[model samples]
Target chain A: MFALILPAVLVVAALLVGPMVLLARISLNQYSATQLMIEATTAQNYLNAVADPYYRGVMLTTLVMAFICTALTLALGFPAAYRLARMESRWKSLVTVLTLIPLLVGNVVRAAGWLGLLGNDGLINATLRGLGLTSEPLRLVYTPGAVAVGTIAVVLPYMILTLSSVIESIPRAVEEAAANLGASAFTVFRRVVWPLALPGTVAGCVLVFILCMNTYATAVLLGGSQFKMMAPAVYDQFSKGMNWPFGAALAFILLAATLVLTVLGTALLGRRYAR
Target chain B: MGQVRAGPGPDTVTREAVTRMRAAPLSPLAAPALAGPGLSVRLGRLAFLAAVFLAYAIVFAPIVMVVVTSFFDQEIVTFPPDGLTIRWYLNAWAQRDFARGFLTSLQIALAATAIGVPLGTAAALALVRATIPGRGFINTVLLAPLAVPAIVAGSALYMFYLRAEDWLDMDIKATLGGLVAANVLITIPWTVRLVTASLAGLDRAAEEAAANLGARPLTVFTRITLPMLRPGIVAAALFSFVASFENLELNLLLVGPGRTTLPVAMLSYLEFRMDPTLAAVATAQILMVTILMLVTDRFVKLSRIV
Candidate 1:
């Protein structure tokens, strides 16, 4: 049994763990423009990342945006998930396929789709002009709003899938029983469904929140070049600035932030619902 | 049916019973009106259905926009007055970068899937069948990559490759093999997840029976366990291929000149031009993935695994 698992263990250790350890080491090194990177032990990279106002603002923006997207996704996805979970119509399978189609399409492609819709001459503007509702394009594309919308669209399916699977297991009989006992529909949801689906909600929110924080292509394409996020900032440091140490530090910061927030959120939710 | 005779039965009646009562052929008037939902409930249901419809519309709007833009005859995509044409697709095909990138992506996805699936299957089998300690810990470790941000993984791998190049005095970064290795890392987690789920559903009695009948362990695995795991293995391969093909952030840092994958090529193209040619490219990709998923679902029921 151990032998059967050795090949995978070796690959993961050598590729994943080895790289991560090397990255941590590199993050402590010093970056010099002439020599690229110098071997040294220093806290300068992390200190610079933390102290710089620009980087601090970018981290904050990423956090807020991630929170907003997660909230919006939950708001929009829960009803759809409940509908799908309890669907008895013949169209259930067709609806499921439709829900899944966007997920299979990559984020880059989806962002491109948003580009065509929200651009100056794109669908939304064209429709607005045709309707005589506005004189100008309204600056829909290349805005923060566009980034949020695109990110929500990309992650919504994931939330729906996660929540629906959990909701499906909750058994319709329970909800019906609550209703039979004269509990209002909202009451049934508050007292029954909400607590039952808390675990899935947490899982979905964490997953979507992580994706939003690390969003690269959507932020780059839809938010335009001026808009900065943690992932793209990390990319720019390595690709354009050629600052490996700083880039490694930024990557670690993003990873740590995501991990800490996810753990904290899960713990808080778990504790609150434990009663 | 016997409970239908109880007084004020609306509280006890199941939804299916009401539906059946409404659908009964012999007595249309016998269907109880009181069992149906009240007017407010009906209105609320209508509102919920509309909300669901709107949600689906938002989810699909961008993808539909891309496909629509791809058919526009104009060079620049302007909505609501363009004639239809397939010229953008032809133009996309003529672009050497997209062509080369598509082939490169296909090869990488294939290589990654081919290698990652078997290794993941073995690990999953060991974890499921063997009474190993710390099984939960090992499972978490295997799935950890899925949780890590792709950009972080890509940067880490890029830096690690550079260090390895220095130590081995050999070029590893910015090569086809290096790119494939990165892709394989991402694919393994999906394979492990799907195959593990599959193994959990499988009955071990056949394997135990074969062992008791004096068949070698290898023979039992090959003839019994592997065959039962066929659907899972196939699903794993399909998903892994899609994952590798669609990957952008991981390949963004690892790709070199002339070794760019399709998503990277598409990104660079978007940076340069906002024409419908990219839309045509994306539409082609969307169609291919949809068809592949539909076909795979025909055999494996993707809803079960995904």
Candidate 2:
């Protein structure tokens, strides 16, 4: 067992904690492009992040967007997941295959697809124009909506795949018993199936939410020039802004939020089943 | 019965025609003939599925657009093209950067995989079997990078490199090795977690049986465990390749004046050119991915890769 798990532990230690520790240690100072402009033993970076409205707003909006997109993916994904659990394997295989194809394509590719679709001469606008729906093209690209759309596209597959596999593993006799006892399909679904499938669904949700919270590619391609999410904001600080300390501070805060959601998601999910 | 009559049958059909139609090929309208009171629901469902298929096409339109626009002979890409040509593909070929970038990417990805796969496989084995000190912390940390947006990881690495360059007496910032190290670190989680799950599902008794036969631990692991873990290993390799290749956020952070990966090049090209040539590049990428997927599916269980 130690043999099996030790390497994983060390790798994680190096990648996750080691870097985070390094970031936290660095966050206390004034690291710049030229050098670590060390103002040792100062909470100035954290203070600066908190006091700045622009940075705070970026954090808030990032949370709001992540939360909403996660919710939407869950909602949209649920029905398909339900269908996967309830349906026969032949149809399930086909639908499941279709759902997962997006995963093969990278985040940038999918985001770019949305960009092309939402562009001025793009499909959506062209269609709207062709139908005489609008005299002028609506600006749909490079907005929050596009970001959400792109994020959803990226996350939807994982949710469905994880949820369906979990849902499928559930004993059919349990669902069948509910149906056999004169429970409506809805009742069987709500009372019996959903409770059983919650573990996988919730797990998938939390995972995607964490992912959405940390997303960069989707936000960059779809949100375009002006819109800023935490990931991109963090990127800007490190690269364009060249303020590593601030970036580190902001990263720590974002991590805290993600950690909280992950805990709540897991605990709530586990306890729900426990009862 | 009502839906059957409402379907796209012969509007001018007579009773005699209805009899003859029964003998002909079953039309799409014949769906209602099979469904009962659930006919409306079934039709609605089929419509919804059709919508999903349409959305699938739309979701993948970038790839489609890229392919169509790449072969375009004319300079500008409009709806109807005047001619079709392989000019862009040749142009892409002409770009010396692609060859260099491709080779660099290939080298880095391969190097990362060679290092990452064993490390991940061994780590997965350890993770599944051991309940050591700081196990929870380790588990969390190992999987933590998945949560760390790649850009942040890249940034952190850049900072680390900048700060520690003198200490390590090494230059990693904007270096190929530096980039590879960062990517390998980020992608390690996926390979480890995936294999860990697969290993957990595998039976241990087989190993026990081998042990009972007095086989050495190394022999048992290599002959039995390695072969059993082949599928997961293949998947890990594919995913690592894809993750490494598709990486842009991290690459953006560390990409130097000269060391540009394909995606970085494409992003830069799109910024200035905004031409079908970028589309051509994108198409080439999509084609590579799609072909990879299909081949991966045929050989390895594609599910395992992700």
Candidate 3:
């Protein structure tokens, strides 16, 4: 048993845990404008992260974008997932495969595709122009809206997949029994299906929220320089600003935020499940 | 509502009859009367399904547009493209650096999958069957990389690799080897999740029977357990390879000049050019994913993974 698990454990230790330790250590180092970092212990990076308006604004933007993206994905995905769970047709597998395509395709490629569709001279504008609806192209490409759309497209499939499995677990007889008890269909759904599906909703929202918050490619290629998010900001600090300490601090904060949310969401929903 | 249930009157009897009618299985005579849902219900369902299909359509539009526009004859990627031709596919093909980068990505993905699948399968087996201490800790740690932001993982690994060379006199950074290590790290999550899920649903009766029949442990595993795990192994291999192949953030940091992957190459190309060549490459990738999905769907139900 030990031998069977040794290889994976070693890889994770060396790659995942070791680097995380290094990241934490780096986060404590002193930053220099001339040199990248000096081997001095300080909480200055974390302090700056908390005290600076720029960093605070970036964190707020990241949080809002993630929240909005999660809500949008759940809104778009729930009905589809509900339908998929109830489907008895032979084409269900095909639909499942179709839903998985966006996930399988690379983010860079998907963002590139969005550039073509959302650019000033791209599809949406071209259509509007051809129809004479507008004489000018709309600036849609490098905006928060583009980031939201791209992120939702990236994470919606995951939401649907999660919700579909949960909804599918619900027995059809329960819904029928409620309907037969003189309850209207809407009432049956509201009281039975909605509550039963809450666990899945929580799980999907948490996962999608994390993915959205950590999104790098969408924010980079679509959001451009005007929009800043946590992941891209971390990248900028480390790569361009040469502030490894600040970057590590930001990354850890992001991880902590995600971890706390996940734990809280699970605990809250797990209690509801118990009741 | 209170008056209706007040007594065991006509209302109570009518409600009981309605319950019995609903609970009863439909006979042949009753089947025609229950031919389908009511018209209003059917219409509502139709509208629901339409909305569902529309959502999928929007989800798929970006990828579909890439594949479609790759065939456009125009130099720039604009909508309402002029002329239709397959010229851009040739352009995408003729890019020597891109071809080389693609080969590098393929090599990395293959190597990562080769290492990841078996190691991940072994770990999953241990997680499911082993009585090792801290099993929950081991499982969570193994899957922890998935939750780490990609850029964070990349930077951490990048810094670690740089320091490792200084400390140990071994250089893996900026090489295909280091890239493979990062790929394997990310790919392990997919392999472990899929294979563990598969193993959880498996019955151990065959293995137990084989062991009782005087078969050695190795023989039982080789002849029974491994065979049962083939579908899962295949699915894991596909997912791990795709994960490695589609990786961009990790490779962006680790890749040096002339040592990039396909996605990284496309990103750099986009920096300098705005042609449909990138679309052509994406279409090719889309084709590859389609073929792999079709093949995997034949062996195991794709929906089962969910």
User: Which one wins on DockQ?
Assistant: 3
Local accuracy of candidate 3 as per-residue lDDT tens digits, B163-277? 8988989877878889999999977877888888788889999999999999999999999999999998898899788888988877777888878899888877765555688
Residues A42-129, candidate 2: write the lDDT tens digits.
7888889889999888888888998898897777676565565455545554455456556766676565556556777666787888
Order the candidates by lDDT, highest first.
Answer: 1, 3, 2
- Assess each prediction's global lDDT (C-alpha) against the native: 0.84, 0.69, 0.81
How would the candidate models be sorted by TM-score, starting from the highest?
1, 3, 2
Clashing pairs in 1: none
Stronger candidate by DockQ (1 vs 2): 1
Look at candidate 3 and tell me the lDDT of residue A75.
80
TM-score against truth, every candidate: 0.93, 0.84, 0.91
The TM-score of candidate 2 is 0.84
DockQ of each: 0.42, 0.22, 0.44
Which candidate has the highest lDDT of all? Answer: 1
Clashes of 1: 0
Answer with 1 or 3, whichever has the higher DockQ.
Answer: 3
Query: Chain B TM-score of all predictions, in order?
Result: 0.87, 0.82, 0.84
Error of 3 at A226 (Å): 0.9
